[model samples]
Target: MFFATTALALLIERFIGYPDILVRTIGHPVQWIGAFIAWLDARLNPESEPGNRLAGMLALLALLVVTGGLALAVALALRKLPYGWVAEAIIATPFLAQKSLAGHVRAVADGLDRSLAEGRSAVSRIVGRDPEQLDRSGVARAALESLGENASDGIVAPAFWLALLGLPGIALYKAINTADSMIGHRSPRYLAFGWAAARLDDLVNLPCARLTGLLFALAAYFSSRTSAKAAFAAMRRDAHRHVSPNAGWPESALAGALGVKLGGPRAYGGRHVDLATMGDGKSELDANDIRDGLSLYGDALSLLAVIAVLLALAF
Candidate 1:
């Protein structure tokens, strides 16, 4: 079920690109789902009367039960909809994009190689770093950073959730993640409201993120062009060093696999976010780094394919 769910997710994403119609409908409704859940949570407690740890735990349970139930219902409906699972599967295949990850990364590099201004603009969409003052190296670094972080957020995490819980699970995961991205900040407005969304997203991605790193190491090992042993070692050594408990795993694994360093100080919203580096090595990055990221994405997908095959055999 887990493996099929993963493949189905890949297939759906590849084909549909989350149709604008679906996005316009589901996306907004999903936001309201969060809003509804938040409202429920608030109703459970009065501001003048704070809840205790036990009350908090109960609230969490209630939230999960409600959210998970709704998600499960949606998954069942998607399965039964006129949209055949076969069609969904076909659409999902292209969405997986092991081949395209590198292409996207390369475009940024190629764009940068042509002009730093062009590179910065292209890379800015994917990365949170300031692009206005970027040079060649900065553009490359920002692109690499986006590649690493997004490999998890945009790929592995979605794959993992979908695999485990089907369409509803994936939908819910995306909702939580999107909410976190939008509102789960330490700002004055969302600190308390976004707490549940942020924490839940982190919890959901915890295992998938680590698994992605391991898959990355295995892929490098199998590639023969790279040292799998080194990749694995580097991942083990540096996976936990990044500020994001989950992102460091795959990013560090890729960095070690490709023999390049990623992560460092960057400007976000005009403020410099001085982050620790992941993987040990010089920070020099180029088209080659993007090449490695592309390779890793392929390897991870191949690994998923193998898992699918093994499951078929076992079943």
Candidate 2:
């Protein structure tokens, strides 16, 4: 049941994606989760505290209970209806983002095809660093890095949780991720207050991050242009060098597969982050590299779907 629900939801999201109209109408689930997190942040998070840590933990607890409870309620209600698993799958579609990730990455390449300025503009929409600071290669690298990291965060992790625990599992995972995005910062304001959220996000992402990397490696193995050996070597050698415990796996895998270097100096919120480079390849990436990265992403996404379907059949 879990595997079938996951497979159905992935297939549905792969085709239609969550529409902007739907997002604009009521708002996306992540936005809703963000709103609730904000409320908790305001009420529970004090400016100064020997209590912010406890407060943050309480906020996280509340978020999990509410999110899981509501999703479980909806799943139960839908199950009472005919073809309820189908309905659950539809409801779960918005949580997984395969098509949209590809779209964003493709838009970077499209923008670069027009002009460098337009490329910077398009990449800015998806990345956090100042777009004005990036050259052509920087823009391409940013897009690929975003594609790699978000593949795990936005799609694989949620799907993993969904297959493990159905609707409530996926919902809980998203809640954690959204909270981490909103409050799990290293900034002074969020530092102590967001400790629990950040740590928990890391814990939950463990399995899926590595899984996403392996999937990308398999994708590379199947492709003539990319190198599976490089991907695997990078994972073993450079993945741990990344600041993020989870993000490095896919980012390094994709970097090696594409034969491009990723991760270096970047500015964010006026602060410079001296990040370690992932792949021992050429740093001069162009728009075409971004397209190649998207091809790799598509292959990985297909592999994930195939795995889910096979698991469904096996169990």
Candidate 3:
């Protein structure tokens, strides 16, 4: 039943996406989660208290109780009604990023085709680094790298939790992810404060990140000039070298599959981070490579959908 629910969620998010009208009216679930994170930060993590790691942990505990508790209550209430499982799928659609991720990546390509400045602006929305420092190849690489990492984080990870523990599971995952995004920085402000959110996000995303890498590798098997073997080799050689434990897997897989190199020095608000390079391919990338990456990601998504169906059948 959970697998079937995930399949329906994939179909819905892949096609309809969340309607703009709905977003304008009630706002998105993530926005609501972000709001809660902000409120907690303002109250508990004040500027005067930079080393409040225990406070941060307690705040995260409060967040878990709120999000997980509310989601469980909703799931229990929905379970008693007819056709409620379909409602669960419909509700889960907003959590997945099938259409939005593709759209953002495509926008970067389109922007590059138009002008370099336009390309930088489009990529800036999706990437955290300084887009102004990017050249043509840099812009394209940034887009593709974001596509790789987010493919697992935004799509596969949530779906994995949804299929495993239903509504509460996904809600809890999203809440933790939101906290990590908000405060899990090495900056003095959050270095000690957001330790739990950052660490837990890494732990939860570990399995799904590797799963997404394998899916991308399998998808590459069907793509011309792309090798699953190369993807696997890249993952093994480069994943651990990355600064992040989870993001490296999918990024290396996609970079290897597409025969392109990603990850180098990137600047965030004038802070330079020298990241380990992933994939042993061409250092330069173009808009065409971004399109190829998109195609490969599409095939991987299809494979995930097929697996969901298989799970529904087998169970």
Error of 1 at 228 (Å): 1.8
Q: Model 1, residue 198: what's the lDDT?
A: 73
Q: What is the TM-score of each candidate against the true structure?
A: 0.77, 0.97, 0.98
Give the per-residue lDDT digits (tens) of candidate 1, residues 178-275.
Answer: 65675466664556655676788789889878877778778886776666676787777887778887888888877787777777788877888877
TM-score for predicted model 3 compared with the true structure: 0.98
Put down candidate 3 lDDT per residue, 151-246, tens digits, no spaces: 998999999999999888889999998899999998899988899999999999999999999999999988786888889999999988889999
Candidate 2: which stretches are off by over 4 Å? 46-51
Against the reference, the lDDT scores of all candidates come to: 0.67, 0.93, 0.92
Candidate 3, lDDT over the whole model: 0.92
- Candidate 2 per-residue lDDT, tens place, 1-315, comes to 599899999999998999889988999998899999999998887565433788899999999999999999999999899899889999999899898889988999999989999999999988989998899999999999999999999999999999999999999999999999989998788888899999999999999999999999989988899999999999999999999999999999999998999999999977888999999999999999999999999999999999999998998
Candidate 1 regions off by >4 Å?
11-71, 78-104
lDDT of 2 at 277: 96
Question: Best candidate, lDDT-wise?
Answer: 2
RMSD of each: 4.8, 1.4, 1.0
Question: What lDDT score is found at residue 198 in candidate 3?
Answer: 98
State the number of backbone clashes in model 1. 9
